[model samples]
Target: MYFGKKNSEEPEIIMEDTIVYACGSADCNGWMRKDFASENYDCPMCGSQLVEEVRELPKIENEYNAFK
Candidate 1:
């Protein structure tokens, strides 16, 4: 028995945080966390409005500017 070897049967851990804002536009794929969104609270893409909703997704870092 080798103590240095770890078991490979352990299950992987997955964390699904509930915090995300999706663009209201049907053709936009922009989304970000509530804490990272702009103060205006608008969609990062398409310059559309955003609605707060609970969704399971990974965290991301992005900056949205409507003046583009």
Candidate 2:
């Protein structure tokens, strides 16, 4: 039997204030990163209009932005 090693050095979670679009409907909890949002701010899950908001989220690359 092989024992797994415990790695103490882990990448730190880098949080940033990012723009996002969230569902306006109280019944829905759908949200998405602004960079990934479409021109029409509509919830793809519940067909609710989305509102822009700032949220603290982890840093990630917006692959869609790469083309621009």
> Best candidate per TM-score, number?
2
What global local distance difference test value does model 2 have? 0.93
- In order, what lDDT does every prediction score? 0.72, 0.93
Candidate 1 lDDT over 1-68, as tens digits, reads: 75796877986555567677888888997887776666887775588988778777654434453334
Error of 1 at 68 (Å): 29
The TM-scores, one per candidate, come to 0.56, 0.88
Clashing pairs in model 1, backbone N/Cα/C closer than 3 A:
none
Off by over 4 Å in 2: none
| Candidate 2 lDDT score at position 29 | 98
Ten consecutive residues with minimal summed lDDT in candidate 2? 33-42
